[model samples]
Target: MARRRQAARAAPEPIRATSMWRVDQVFLTRKGQRVEVICSLVNDRSGLRNLSVIAPTEDPREAVRHAARFIAGKGNVSTARNARVRWTREQSTTLQDELVRDEQLEDDFQDEFEDMLAAVRDQMR
Candidate 1:
């Protein structure tokens, strides 16, 4: 029994590294009926909860590393603040794979702005 106990103690435990505070496995409800969605509904899953991002291009692992280093009082103080945004495994590919604009968009609002103003002004008269 001593040998068995020692062997059991020697066995390594599984490690699950994650920052997920909580995850609610929700189901679809429509017209008082519960629907078990089977297909990989990518669009439906993409949202602010765990799926949203500040800088979608940035790697969450780097942020984790930065936060860890800051928490340990080794890295720069700004490291934790700068590396604020974190993404789960579900958000990684969806964000990384998508194309994001880097340039400033042209202001075409002026075209409709005058028309809308005029219409509003006319409505008030």
Candidate 2:
């Protein structure tokens, strides 16, 4: 019983480094769905790279719109009107693979960021 309570009280983990992509833009359909999204990122503190979205859905455009609104509201960010790129299925697959590979790299930055956040939370406690 005590162990169960303790586990329940444990803090949630921080966002993983692999999930931290600097989003460049999000494109939506007129019906309000997230059709696609584009993200700009740096893998090794070097050149900028891009990620293309390839979510399987009935209506990609609508999906894109939904994603745009969700990200904007959650992160207090907005997508540029002119930056929306029409995504091909092949390109989307490639980008998805790239994102996976890039995230596989050692997550030093994420460790630092989470450590700082944990320190702050501990201080407040």
- In terms of lDDT, the best-performing candidate is 2
Model 2 lDDT tens row, 1-125: 98999888969777555433344433222223333444444333244555444434536443444344334333322222233334444444575643332221113223333444455556659
lDDT of 1 by residue, 1-125 (tens): 88888977766755544221211221111212221111111212242232211221233333222223223231111111111222223433676533332111101112222344455456659
Off by over 4 Å in 2: 1-38, 41-56, 89-125
lDDT of 1: 0.26
Clash pairs, candidate 1, are none
> Mind sharing the TM-score for model 2?
0.30
Worst 10 residues of 1 by lDDT: 74-83
| Model 2, global lDDT | 0.40
Highest TM-score, which number? 2
lDDT scores in order: 0.26, 0.40
